[model samples]
Target: MSYEMKPLEFISVKFSIGLLLGISCGWLFPIPQELAILLSTICLVITSLFFLFENYRKGIYFGIAAFLSFISLGIVAITLAQPKLSAHHYSRDYNQDNGFWILELREVLKPTNFNRRYIFQVHALNDSARSGLILGSIQKEDKISDLKVDNHLLYYGKVHPISPPLNPYQFAYDSYMESKGVYDQIYLNPENSIQLKTTGKSLKGWAAQIQLHIKKELSSTPLGVKEQGVLRAILLGQRNDLDPEVYRSYKDAGAVHILAVSGLHIGILLLIIRFFLKPLMSSYFGRSTSMIVTLLILWVYALFTGVSPSVVRAVAMFSFITYALYLKRPTSAINILALSFLAILLIQPKFLFQVGFQLSYAAVFTIGWIYPLLIRFWRPRNRFIKRLWKLFAVSLSAQLGVLPLCLYYFHQFPGAFLVSSMLIIPFLGILLGLGILLVLLASLKSLPDSLALVYNQMIRTMNELIGYIASQENFIIRQIPMDRPGLVLLSVIIILLVLSLQKKKFVYLCFLGIAIAGFQVWNLYLLHQNRQKNEVMILHQVASTAILYQNGDVLYVMTNDSMRIKTLVENFELNRRIQSTRSIPVPNSFYLGQDQWILLDSSGILPPVRKNIKGLILTQSPRIHLGRILEQSCPDRIIADGSNYADDIRRWRRSCQIYGIPFYSTAEMGALSLGQL
Candidate 1:
């Protein structure tokens, strides 16, 4: 096989790369919005002039101008996306400590164990107007007021910053929320807050109404709770009602994408639509009408699915494909993919950081790129065998493309993905087609119970199959560690290897080998760093106090709540590649290197020997006199874990402030390393 390409062929690809790089740079080092705008304008003007001057357009100056323009455009896009840049953003002037906030509920997020979470748009802080998104957590209890999207909320409370992870290598939810333009969170009690009525409506609110209607209609059908949840996710991209166990099963079986209305679902639906309109393609007007109808349905579905990045991407990409097919023109798949990628980023630059957005594009591109190559390797004579081979190729390609990201973000891989994919892909089309018809019928209150039963049974069977695959514990690999550099190196290796095979170039093979070597070296570096770690961390667990001491590759945990901390400890150990972990009872005192620690529990009894007390830890709501303790020990710092009472901690903080001593609260500052403290 041979391939040749001109330098100017992938213009979109080049610009996309430049835009991506610019967005990354802008995120890492944010600039003033005005400066971003000025830079973008200057670069765009220069590029325009270079293009207008035909003589100058042929030289490197034009190239530099164009590159700068793309980069600046990306910077401007991200800058403009920042809510804080807006004059009305709540954080700029809203009083956090004391204020009556008027908030409009924007979206309902999945509920946590104790709270129903929501994204609220700030309307006013007392008399001052405000804007920007804030996270609202209302306690889940009986008689809680029903709050819908776009409903106004009035509350008197302090807005607190989102808490960071309390353990090393744990998820950074604070960063995640910030990326979504939500910085602060508020805790609401029924007594302290009230829902206000709103006359205005938003597109999201309209979608919510439709979703609520669908939910109500589905409830009237024969579909079970889990079945209804899956149907909603497939048709509307709403997963809030999905059963946890069912969701876990799908996740473990690597068929979770079936529940997400991404490219696969959209692609299947597109094929179904095209199939029904096949006879119309015989005439020119019929073809045009079919194309128009297909596009309208696809876009309406995208809107119905909440217009998530993945859905929008799929719709936009296939929209181009549909138009190209309508015109009978040869269009490069990569170019269309890049065009959509560029368009989405130009509108919502923050989406670049979203896991779903990244995974969706990666899977689609790899399938387009690698599936053909893999299918060519096996030419099965039988029709059934050939179709199965093609499905396997696609499954393999997508998995390979997203492997690094999966490891980096989720740290797990389903070894049974192939089996599950084989079972699901061939049937997914029928499932989606039937599911969509049932949804439309149900919405109109015209669905027959018999048809509902069939759809429900199909969903139940699929769920059971996925659950069976997930139950094979030996095939599920968990806690696999991957870092950013490793992800990059692995991606590079995959790309180089593919290029080597496709182009039959020894140079590409040499680069592939180097990439693999670099990956190994990076792994070694990480292992070396982990082996050199030696420190003690006081982990913050609600209603419990725990201490972790690490020496080389071994971890020693001191806490009575072993069962409670099992997952946390396992995640920490796996992330750091610890060789061993030992759990022990919580001791009254411990020593690590030069640091001496004393622990006081509910008994409030302090050790008699107070000299050389490096740190004093209060736990289990100790009732000791903090001022007296400070006078006697005057330790370097006072540490309180989550087990301590809030009121006691506040009093102790005041004492520390008066005495000019450092105070560390695990509840506020997250887990503390004694040495760092």
Candidate 2:
């Protein structure tokens, strides 16, 4: 017997899919802002007409019109979201050279090795009022005291465009910043930067102040520093003070989400709140009041926790569910979830590209879809067994949903996630509740040392348990290779298989098999391509030089540096799907196919060659006169690796220009690739 399929209960799901497709199309194939606006207007008119005409409104025609409208709207949203398209954008109007600008510090970013960074809202340029965003970095040694959100600053500096990735398959910092509407960056000179006092404070500023106050209050307690850090992360969504080791442990244990104040935390808090409000549901007035109170608390928590995108998303989603449940209407949870997804994307379409947003929604949907299916398979009568089974089911479902994403982005999966989830999740509600209560008391200056100590011990115990799980490294899968095509195909297979299991349908199974076949074919194609690949690449490494020679399934690396770049090489191997790699010391001469290349180091010795070389590679700030070398060798191009000094490279570049020979610098133009050589 086949499971009966339910009729489409919510039209919003279809609309959401249409909107999602439209947003994806808009991103993949961007249209000009003006054209997008025009298209949107046309689509809107068509949709309006379809709805107004009684004949068209009843069938597929109306749906098509609505979908087209959403697609056009998505195009407009993305085009408009681009700050570079705006006439008043700083990059479009201002000088990149030294200029006076008024900037308000909007957000504090994680500090890098050399600098403390912040997202600054550009308020004025050359005393002209304008609006934009730019990244500002101050040297760690010149740190300004008491910097807070909404603080204004007068800066005199040169704005530079964010640099592109310096290596293939490297994370694109420029693209990431551009997505967030930050197009340029300014490095502050201490002498030219000055803080400006501002009277008006935004909600974010107030939130920061509240967090600071809480931190200060908590410092007086007997809580351990690590415990305090975890508390701040849990309650205030701040992780700047978290110990790196502890964070790594949590990540390895696949429980880092617990510290991030995402959907799981929000959901747990909601459950706690609902349990407390169960009695109020008996009366309509009480229920309504409880609903209002729950919403207020949730929103307050969202705001209090820095109003992060993830927090806001979770709150918005749960808020919808709360209202739907309280109204006593036959509402589908999937519909509510889709409505929330649609709403978020409509407001911030770029969020569709965010890893966090995708992972969160994926986990939630899988939990909702798969948990019930698992429960039906095993109905345990014992209360403890049933609770354990439910937790396992939810954990397994979430992990399955996010597995592809994790492999794609992070290239690893924690096999111990189920164990961590089973162990920690059951106590998460109590922990969150206690943390909240402790924070409130701390804010009121009434938190006792005894209570603080107890909470601190609990945190320590949790951390230890997580660390133990993470230490079982044998179960942790790392360096799993996956690409965008594989991600999509695998996702299809997972979805079809789940559907097949849920509905007991042969059609779904057939589709699942097709998806699996496609995935396998893709891998085989990649493997074949890797086997036929042959290339020479000069990598960009700071204060060092490295060159790669790839032949078929093997990679050879020649480097002057002794530093352990095993991880970097592993990443490369994963991307290439190579069988093996060999490392060797850098030699003065190398051959690519029949072409000869000569490396000139600090010694500046030019070896006598009978024939003209293919290229002259510069390394270690070679002191040889480039004009002489050009006159002597007359190679096709000059290449400088990262080991060369900037002044020397500039001098060589000028010489190359003078001689009309092509020059490549790994530092500026990224890794030089001699394709298929």
Give the clashing pairs for model 1: none
Number of the top candidate by TM-score? 2
Residues 1-677, candidate 2, lDDT per residue (tens digit)? 11222214457777777778878887778877888899999999999999998989997889889988877877887778777777778777775578889999899888888888899999899888878899988888885774789999999878898999888778899989877888889888669899998879999898888888998998989998999998888777789989899999998999988888888999889988999998998886988988998999999999889888888888999999888877877666677888898888888888888888999999987877777788899999999999899899999999989988998998889999999999999998889999999999999999998999999999999999999999999878877889999999989888888888888888988898899999999999999998898998888887888888888889998887646455556767899987888988888887777888898888989766646999998989977778988997889999998888889889999999999999999999998887687
At residue 65, what lDDT does model 1 achieve?
Answer: 88
| lDDT by residue (tens digit), candidate 1, 528-626 | 998988878899888888888888889999986887788789988987889899988888987766667899999988766547688888999987788
The local distance difference test score of each candidate is 0.86, 0.86
> What's the TM for model 1?
0.95
Would you list the clashing residue pairs of candidate 2? none
Shift in Å, residue 670, candidate 1: 1.2
Ten contiguous residues with the weakest lDDT in model 1: 1-10
